[model samples]
Target: MSVTKALEGAVGWLTLNRPDKLNSMTRDMVETMAAALKAWRDDAAVRVVVLTGTGRAFCAGADLKAGNGAAAPQPGEKDSLDVIVDFFDTLRNFPKPVIVAVNGLALAGGMEVVLSCDIVLAAESARLGDAHSNFGVFPGGGGAALLPRKVPDNVARYLLFTGDSLTAAEMKTYGLVNEVLPDAELTDRARALAEKLAGKSPLVLARMKRVAANACDKTTADAIRHELLELRDHKRSYDIQEGLRAFAEKRKPEFKGY
Candidate 1:
């Protein structure tokens, strides 16, 4: 299988298993990922999603040799670029947190996937870049649009125009990466972070995710108004009462995810 899905407690792990190809993404793998994400969306027990790859590399980018070398349409086949956009959209709209553990190289399409994720924990030795220009192609996924959002326009343009790879530490400096860890400690750190999130009220986490994204595009006054409305709705959840009572009693809150 190009992709594998497994659950570790409340975290859903999706691994890109094509090590021989440096875990380059294929059409089937992208489709499989979309399906798995869709199934996990309604799974209450799954509070977070962690995406990683097996072996030394996270993903080298799209498997160009698999098709026409460009995500071009094949006879009677769905457009590969369309599939990639849908996959990114799915991750963007997913209510729960999506964390990416970038263990190694992430280029072109791989970099786009990282942009789609909510958080990124990259190994110190990992490298990231937008290499489409090197191949005479442009970002067909979300890289062009998403990269500028995370990092400065000048830096984003430099990386995309030059097709240069940045070390994980450098990417962190650009504010695209959340943390950089030793290659050996990457997986454990990612899981630890996910576990911390899982312990929170899933409903609240979902709400916060929405609020953060919504606030980004709203004006200051409108954002505050929207937040107030959301807060009113949140107070109706059972976890709010439990949290308040637990705080007063000096005990850890056990959220019911209401």
Candidate 2:
């Protein structure tokens, strides 16, 4: 399959497998990932997800080289933006954190994928940018809006306006990445982080993710004001009681999705 979806240990790695085109996304690949992520949200065994791409380019964006979709983007009978937006929202609201293990060049739409991730670990030699402006379309893949929120406004503006590629080191200094590991170590590092997150209580992680997201969101103040109320509700949840009982019994909690 062009999308390699696999779960090993506490982590799920979804690799964009089309290295021939710099691991670019096709509609099928995007939808497949969205579906997989949705399933993982409910699966207890799957705690963390590592989204990456194969070879030298993390993703060359929307596979422009193929006859169907081009860099300049010819008008199509197809409605590409809608499905893509849905998937983007799925990432934005993901209950569990997603780590984007960026190992190479990630341009245009690929930049949106990274922005959507909860955490991003880039390879030391990796490059990132939004080339959509250069090609003529407003970055429908969420770069224009999301990137600035992810990083500094000036930096985001500079990248969007100039279409300049930022190096991994620059991104780290700009607070755009969790860290930058060596190219060979990027996957392993991302897996380690995923495993670390997976070790915690699933319900707690989910609630905490929502809380943290809300803190950074437009509703930060109201969310914080009502945080304890939500936390109290979470504590009364069946999973919370199970977690405490499991700890007391020295056993793993068996959650029943209540």
Candidate 3:
């Protein structure tokens, strides 16, 4: 598979797999990512996931050069969650924390994938953008929704309108980048973050994720009420009691996903 491979050890590493093409995604790669992420979502060992590239670029975008078989999508195409459907949607709503470790350029659909990640740490030389607009399509992935949530409206609009790439420093200023490191340190930094998150209680993280996701869509009164309900439900989960006991006893909590 041009998408590269494997799901193991609580850390699923998805390398775009086609470095020669700047690791641009092929239909196969997209499919592979969707399936792999889904598998990880429910895996007990997996607490954090990482996406990266194998070579010069993280992923320059969808592979235009992919030979005709499954076929390449048109520049301005849309379907009712067609073709790339599973690929984009899976990344967006994945319950577990996903991290994008950009070693180089991440453009168009590739950049869209990164935007869906819970966190992003980039190499100092990395280039990230939504160049699909330049090719005449609105971002088919979650860029339209994800970008605005991560940065200022004006900044998101600027990139959407111009289809320009942002440097690591510039991207950091806009707040999408959680951390930045030298090229050689990209994997290390990503692994560090993944390990830290993986050590947390998955049940607590899940509930926290629900609250965070919900708060963005509700009023303060509704949010508070929702949170109370969440806590009420949370009490039934073992992780909550473990967390509390751990806090009181001054020891690490052993989270059993309840």
Off by over 4 Å in 3: 67-81
* Local error of candidate 1 at residue 253 (angstroms): 1.8
Give candidate 1 misplaced runs (Cα > 4 Å).
69-77
Worst 10 residues of 1 by lDDT: 65-74
lDDT of 1 by residue, 1-258 (tens): 889999999999999999999999988999999999998998888999999998878998999888576555678877887788888889889999999999999999899989989999999989999988998887887788889998999999998999999999999999999999999999999999999999899989888888888887899999899888889999899999999999999999998789
Tens digit per residue, CA lDDT, model 3, 96-208: 88889999998888888888888899999998888878877666787787788888999998888899999988999989888889999999888878888877888777777
Estimated TM-score per prediction?
A: 0.95, 0.87, 0.90
Better of 2 and 3 by lDDT: 2
Top TM-score model: 1
> Deviation in angstroms for 111 in model 1?
0.6
Q: What is each predicted model's overall lDDT from 0 to 1?
A: 0.91, 0.84, 0.81
Candidate 2, superposed: residue stretches over 4 Å from native? 67-78, 238-258
lDDT tens readout by residue for model 2, 1-258: 889999988788899999888887877888898899888887878888899988898987886554255344367644567668878888879887789999899999899999888888999989999988787767777899888888899999999998889998899898988899999999888888898877776677777788777776647678777678778888778878888899999998766434
List the candidate numbers ranked by TM-score, top first. Answer: 1, 3, 2
Q: Give me the displacement of residue 257 in model 3, in angstroms.
A: 1.3
